[model samples]
Target: MSTMPTLDTPVTLTISPDGGIDGRSRRYEKFLGDMAGVYRDAEAWQAAVSARGADELVYWVDDHRYQEGPGALIVGTSTLLPGRIGDEFAVTRGHLHAIADRAELYHCLSGHGVMLLETVDGQSMAVELTPGKAVNVPGHWIHRSVNVGDEPFVTLFCYAADAGQDYALIADAGGMKSLVVADGDGWMLTPNPDHTGYRKA
Candidate 1:
């Protein structure tokens, strides 16, 4: 548990009408889809990308990358774009911590979604989230979130900055071994064939 700092100089965060974090945020427009580079579906994927706009804004990362000694903490909120990649919902580019023993925490601020977690040791899980919910991400887990609601999904996070992220691992693996998708009125989990070489749970 970390305490809020008593600052001589007050730092402020402002949220725009569209949920953007003022001054301290980055946006990603080229988010890879699950079908990206699937040779068989290249045409379909290309059409979708063209129709939807290839550089559609995927997510907004707002953070105060503050260092407190050798150990540091990052406070931020990720606002996920609302839409689907084929049948799958839009998701964050997930990552595993470079420092395998480090953990992270997330608190849902608004909208609805699911958080996916996996480990090198063959463990995997998905937790649903909504406003006001908090989740503790244990060490050694690779994690990401998917927006399942109609509106933009947003969540606040606090994590060890020392636990640098290794995104290449997940990208090289073609993303998580499972995915959450729209199933009728709700959503369901489905295995990602691209990740067949990896274990799920």
Candidate 2:
């Protein structure tokens, strides 16, 4: 069910290439310590925490949601710092929308990245993104961002305001089916051996 805003006023936002959302309503951040079982290389992750300290910021998001109804939209930005845990790249703790069938758009603003997308029923894809490139992610697909460059990978994103995230989907499934990994000086998509398949939400 959708509800119209009581005050139907227009809102403007300034999105920066470095992942800043000037009119964002909220800011969320994740540190190395926040990722416990997110990485396949557990030992490598642990060693990284020991070496770089667990408080190191890995990624963050800034978003603006002006209304609360299903008809409303949330515009946001994601900034992911570059690093590697074994062959795996730095990633956002991915999710499927809580509504399950809500689509989203991600446009690269800076640096390089890969949109790792997978379906609950074994379908998968890895799409590389650079400045000016975007991916229209269809509904029912779980998605995560991977930073494979030396600089911060930033993106501008927009989706239905009512489409909330279910972040535990990937963790519960033992991670996504495909991983965006290092391949020489470039990147590649490889199967995640530990994935036990998604448990439909």
Tell me, what's the RMSD of every candidate? 5.1, 2.6
Runs in model 1 lying further than 4 Å from the true structure: 1-18, 23-44, 197-201
Which pairs clash (backbone N, Cα, C closer than 3 Å) in model 2? none
Backbone clashes for every candidate come to 0, 0
What TM-score, to 2 decimals, does candidate 2 have?
0.96
Cα-based RMSD of candidate 1 = 5.1
Local accuracy of candidate 1 as per-residue lDDT tens digits, 1-201 = 999876434457775434556656354343544336431234656777788666666777777663443456777778887777667787777877777778899888888989989887667789999987878999888898889999888888878878888876775676677878789978998887777443332
Candidate 2 local lDDT, 145-196, one digit each (tens): 9999999999999999889999988998898898888999998988889999
My TM-score estimates for the predictions, one after another, are 0.81, 0.96
Q: Which run of 10 residues does model 2 get worst, by summed lDDT?
A: 4-13
- Candidate 2: segments with Cα more than 4 A from true spot: 1-5
